[model samples]
Target: MPAVNRRLVTDYDLQDAMERQIGIRVFEHDHIVHSGGAILRFDDRTVVIQAGVSDLSYFNRADCEFFELKKR
Candidate 1:
């Protein structure tokens, strides 16, 4: 885990914010909630997760993971 961007999204809008982003990382220990999609990882920067699949966390709820936009 790294320093997450507090300004990324509020607790009330986490899901929506992640949906909008082209690439976002949703970490899960058991089953991969979201997958089979394209993701972009910059040089020591952010990861973009393209949507259009099952919302893993939503279906089988879990602890919310932190994230950042990753400024270069």
Candidate 2:
């Protein structure tokens, strides 16, 4: 995990990430909730992340503590 300068906090931020095809890692406190996933889609309250080739993970926007953009 490299250093990230920006954190995705708003829906617009997530939208930008999705459009840019950026990878995101979700965390709750110091624990990782999701890792090495790309933004597949997002709504007002939830975000869907592509976990693997065919796996998708859903997360609530308010439940996530942090969304870190991974530098590829």
Candidate 3:
């Protein structure tokens, strides 16, 4: 992982990241809550993160404070 260049702050930003298949680490209150996951999908209220192949995690848009792109 490298320094994050973009902080996903809006629904559009999240959607774009998902569409691009960009990996992301999610943070809540400045602590990492989700890492090593691929952005599966996102909408106005929720974002889905997929870990490995079958594990899917659902997180509220409001609960996530930061979304940082992970370098491939």
Per-residue alpha-carbon lDDT of candidate 2 for residues 1-72, written as tens digits (9 for 90 to 100): 566646798878888888887778887666788877789998878889996899999988777754656554
Q: List all candidate RMSDs to the true structure.
A: 10.2, 2.4, 2.3
- Indicate the residue-level lDDT of 8 in model 3: 88
lDDT of each: 0.39, 0.78, 0.77
lDDT of 3: 0.77
Score candidate 1 by TM-score against the native: 0.29
* Candidate 2: pairs in clash: none
Most accurate candidate by TM-score = 2
Clashes of 3: 0
Clash count, one per candidate: 4, 0, 0
Clashing pairs in 3: none
lDDT of 1 by residue, 1-72 (tens): 453433223443444455545334454564334532334322222334544564222321234343434434
Arrange candidates by TM-score, descending.
2, 3, 1
Task: Name model 3 segments beyond 4 Å from true.
Answer: 70-72
Q: Please report, as a residue range, the 10-residue window in candidate 1 with the lowest summed lDDT.
A: 36-45
- CA shift of 41, model 1, Å: 23
Model 3: lDDT of residue 71: 57
